[model samples]
Target: MTKTVAHIEKVLEVANSTSAAALSRLAASWRRSAERHGLDPGEHRGPRRLEGTHLCERLGAFEKLMTVAAPRLDNLYSLVGQSGCAVLLTDDDGVVLDQRISAADTAVFEAWGLCVGADWSERHEGTNGIGTCLAEQRRVIIHRDEHFYARNTAMSCIDAPIYGAEGQIMAALDVSSARADQTEAFNRLIGAQVAQTARAIEEANFRAAFEKARIVVAESDDAEAATLLAVDDHDLIIGATREARRVFGFDPLGALAPRPANDVLGRADGPTGFEKAERAAVIRALTRAGGNVSEAARQLGIGRATLYRRMKRLGLDQT
Candidate 1:
């Protein structure tokens, strides 16, 4: 049997396996591709490409993301382009919005439907890197025969999901290579870079969304995912990253209700109180004034003597 026939048979065998618990992520994805997506592993048809007005509309929807991600895509390509890889950025629906590929590899990637306007969602393309990453909302590496489709088995893809400012997946960053000698270890290294670049794009988008808010990094066990919070001038948490929302119990979608930063961070203040707010205001004024009592009092629009008395009452140190 040819390699394609062998790969098709292998995919069918794994998809029909009964041991669901023991299946690896790739196996699970294969099963999903066969059962959920109803994809034919033996199919040799190329991916569908949106053209003309349809392509432009899809690109327009992700214009902001493409703008923020352009530089990142360039940098990632610089790192991996020499390896005969193509860098692609796709919207949440798996429509490729932007791509960077060396001229030498352009025809090859285009032939494989890795160009702009091509759809790579799991439902369309089976268990490939970009598709599966967006499907599972995580980073993924689909190397060679790990792809459900026999035709896609020659390429290796590394991808990471990029989350928008609202803590939802807005795009995916993918690097694909058709090199025959690519190894899993090398793919892992590329996967790390892809994941880091995706996070950088996510952070840039988040920062732009809350330009006036103070961005703080929250503690997280997963280094690949960013845990961030955006605080307003009043110390209210106005926004959070996906991981932060998951970790801190914030609403995963929609506008977040403003909560005191201290409360969310589990600091000393349990609830907002008049005294706490007043003390916080005084502390902020003092900090802004570089600990100068007169300047702080002026900023607070209170007499120095009154400010000192309030400080004393609030147990603030006046050195």
Candidate 2:
């Protein structure tokens, strides 16, 4: 097995050996941190589906989301020294779901937004991100020089997969930094914390989208199902089409939806003629010029700042 996978198996093995009280004390920060990712603290009981795994295997946002995980687990990694990057999460299939890195140190990972939506299948990129976690189903840390990707070899990452009630692989959580210590204690702490963070997100998504009486997150399996679910909820949802994502600059088919209707407008229906009237005229000229604010300003006989002000007032997705 690769280093990442081997790490996961070992973490699980050791975690299983701990008592329930001990584990809870160990993961206390995890429970509190999940609430930040939009999960209810009352929901997380413990690692319920973590056993009976000899036969089976599996695994799995935001700056707003990261703020929650950071304070809870900060002491885990940065105890001795600072890390270049912090937490990461991946979906059930080992796709790099979302990341939170220090803005000052972001360039190290942003070679091409390396931690956002990148898949971690051994077949795709290599044994990185949660690819090896999906392979091993536990917490693992592939520190600097242990990574298989030549470019990623300089980085150290600790990863763990979280599971749901049905024992399905929900997500993966990770913490990373460029620094390496001979002890690797920080990796162990941060990797375990990341796994707890994923567990929290899974629980949050379940409570928010799945249990909600009205709201529904549209999954990609069937467009028809989303269409059917969104019948009377039109005012609440923006619909699950590429047009909606592109119109708003939102990543398409996302679970952590952007601002809700109440956030965008006092009332659901915008001014009936607003888009086609003043805003429409501005947008038309802007679109004609291919979103060139300066050109659109000249076409509309307005200053660049004036054009920008109008877009914000109208809440146009793109200027």
Candidate 3:
């Protein structure tokens, strides 16, 4: 056996044994995948690619996601490029939607089959970054020889999962490098960056999905870590980011139900906060009720005259 494969076999032996002392969580995942999928660490498997109609259909289904994620992917690339890495965006199914590879490193990346429309699911690509992150539904760093397959030992990978407004995983953002060997500190740094970028993408997606709702950005010590809540015209929470749900101590499933925004966010202490929130709520009500003044009034639990007065005061009458 080759040296690399021999090393992998020994690692697997340790992983499969009863003693889990030396096995990292990721290594344990590799073992679980081996048992579940009957994977062979010794063999190199090329990533599967969807072709022709299948490829087109997959792309079509993910068109909206691509549109929302492209700019964020570009930004992530700029941040990680200095470290000789590229960014990849993939759908929940592990079908790559898009990639950003530096022109100088195109050949190196292409050789590993990191390209648009390629399937990188765990079933197809073994224990690589993108696939494993989706399988585990968490952030991961697969550095060098940590990869299950011997052939993938040369590259280092970091990936983070992006959750949808409904709390389901929507995609994975991966940053990978083959230029230089990666250290644990560097992996952690890049992993954090990847996760932050993924959260930004999720926030964008949340806003896009609730474009007409009043977006409530909750107060946070870390602006990047703030939670986003979408409140309808009746001041009821319609949707929220996963972080928002967690930070605000909300039940994940209960976030779907329409609850008073003030009940969750707490009423503003002064007139300024109250008036702004009230005006925003009125506008949202009008929007959700489709500009029907009577419907809007009903939703706001106010008479038509009151609704009209609020609109006039808020300068929404001009629109």
**Which one wins on TM-score?**
1
Alpha-carbon TM-score of each model against the true structure: 0.84, 0.40, 0.78
243-275, model 2: which lDDT tens digit per residue? 223333445444425345344334356542213
Give the clashing pairs for model 1. Answer: none
Residue 20, candidate 1: how far off, in angstroms? 4.5
Candidate lDDT (C-alpha), each: 0.86, 0.48, 0.78
RMSD of each: 5.5, 16.6, 6.4
Write down the TM-score for model 3: 0.78
lDDT of 1 by residue, 29-54 (tens): 89999998899999889998899999
Model 2 weakest lDDT span, ten residues long: 224-233
Error of 2 at 204 (Å): 3.0
- Clash count, candidate 2: 3
What C-alpha lDDT does candidate 3 achieve relative to the native structure? 0.78
